[model samples]
Target: MIIELKSLDEIDPCEFAYYANDPNINTYLRNSFPAPYTLDHALSFITHSLQHHALDFAIVVDGKCVGCVGVTFQKDIFLKNAEIGYWLNSQYWGKGIMSQVIKMLCSYLFSNYTIHKICADVFAENKASCIVLEKNGFIQEGYRREHIYKDGCYHDLILYALWRNSDEY
Candidate 1:
């Protein structure tokens, strides 16, 4: 399968809405990603993407927005680091798409920015994500026990990071 990461403007709002609304997909992500994701939310996201000059991208598969990925660069003393985020359609699960997407994004971020680290904090229950990050050369830096409270309970957060000058990067 061919997967291309494109800027937000290059993606269709309708297609974006179609993919962003998945409950399973939203389960592991932050609460900001609404469960009943609507056209309005997609439009709002598009607007933010346009205005923020965000590192975000729409994961395009054959011209359709099947997933999304991005990074948030830190400020001040942490300017050399960024946090990575991503999600794929449930229908595309177990297809090895996200690993490649993560690799591609990491490569771009390391190449284009002066970032020294790219990281992600995955819910401890998410075994697949932890494995994927490990496969991509992200080391387990720390574990925050019960670092988050969501979906009506507490959840641990696993911190994973990749260094810019490392062989992995």
Candidate 2:
């Protein structure tokens, strides 16, 4: 089970769309990740990724592009902060794939960029995602009550973080 983080260019839009169309996978993701995910959405996302290769990556498992991991850098006063996010194909879940992917992404960000802290906003109900972040040395920093309004309901949001100087990494 070779897991790799590669540029989105390595995959076609269809292959990306095929794996990303899972509604379950999108539940924990941001609202920007549309449901009924289409080829056009994949193509658009790929195009956007092409311009921000430094921040986004396609998660490849045994040569198949099955998911993605990325960080969004904050601007102005928070330039050193980046918010991390990821999603994996359900078929590829529970194999510790995301744990490795998060480590790879953190290493890349800390080594290549001026990032000081990397944080993740996870839905409180998503224990699996929270575990992946904890495995990568991210500590729970805060919990916002009813912070995420998704699927016509409010969901709690848990904030987790890892600093570049943290020994846990």
lDDT scores of the candidates, listed in order: 0.89, 0.90
TM-score of 1: 0.97
For each candidate, what TM-score against the reference?
Answer: 0.97, 0.96
Runs of candidate 1 with Cα error greater than 4 angstroms are none
- Model 2 CA deviation exceeding 4 Å by range: 52-54
lDDT for 111 (candidate 1): 82
**Which lDDT tens digits does candidate 1 get at residues 77-133?**
999999999998898878888988999999988888889999899999998889889
Q: Which residue pairs clash within candidate 1? A: none
Candidate 2 lDDT tens digits, 1-169:
9998988887877988999998789887888998888999999998977876557888999989999887799999999999988999899889999999998889988988888999899999999999998988999999999999998999999999999989954
Report the C-alpha displacement of residue 19, candidate 1, in angstroms: 1.0
